[model samples]
Target: MSHPHGDSKRTVWYRTQFSSWMIAVGVVLAIALVVIAAINASYRTVSLVLLIAAAAFLVTGGIKVTVSAHGVTVASALVPFLRRTIPLDRIAHASARWTRPREIGGWGYRWKPGLSAVSLRQGDALWLELVRGTNFVITVDDAQTAADLVNRYLPGPGEGR
Candidate 1:
């Protein structure tokens, strides 16, 4: 986590690891497809699809969660609409401790029954209790620090002043 010099408010960046793996795997697959296409012309169609998929991953893969004094925001590197911003006031509680992807019906963006999650990898995450609809959860590299940072902005007991 690196902090900017001029920014007075606290800000933390949560880097994603799953997207890196996806892009790497996609590139290798695309290269193999091109090789196959050269050997046999019929494989060109498959190669095109592989290339498109690789490009999609490049555009919509990496995720970065930023926590500042104002709020917590989850943003996609390439797409602006993919960003989700939750003000610090909306955060009821920020806790660490996560479940496996399998428990939440695989990673990425998933919803099951009444629960929804945005997770890239299976590990510790910042489980957020929101004041609105449902809770929001996101997997992060450092959950303890994130939770502590979030908790710091939350209002204390019996003190709305």
Candidate 2:
């Protein structure tokens, strides 16, 4: 749904699909365990483990993405503690980039090895370079859409592509 205000400002929302994969794998394993349990009477322990694991996957796979007139928010099932918000005024520049998995290396949020290393995913990213020598970079799945949002709300100098 579109925001209530007529403002043209945009917000790009993003979240990783890894949790989905985990959930899928869990479901499959659970099914396999159930089948094996039916055939082997001694595999009750294995079946129980698989069932628990499957539940975990299903819970963690539910990631959510939401965008509003003000900013973007991403929520994940696997990482229940993760909550990130990028305000319009805090953003300096926004773009999308592709990087190798190993290059990104670390899990969850990551940055490249150089001074200007951006997010590793191919999603949208906003560069928030504050005045206090603090820079914050965030990535979202929809790059162009997110960029458009930033353009509408906070137009930087010469920022149209």
Top TM-score prediction, candidate number: 1
Error of 1 at 134 (Å): 2.0
lDDT of each residue in 134-154, candidate 1, tens digit only: 677877778777787788767
Overall lDDT per candidate, in order of appearance: 0.72, 0.52
Worst 10 residues of 2 by lDDT: 114-123
Q: Which stretches of candidate 1 lie over 4 Å from their true place?
A: 2-13, 25-56
Residue-pair clashes, model 2: 1
| lDDT value, residue 101 of candidate 1 | 74
Q: After TM-score superposition, what is the CA distance of residue 39 in candidate 2 from its true location, in Å?
A: 18
* lDDT (tens digit, per residue) of candidate 2 on 31-133: 8888888989899787877797776555545544444556655555455565565555555554444433344443334444432322334334444443344
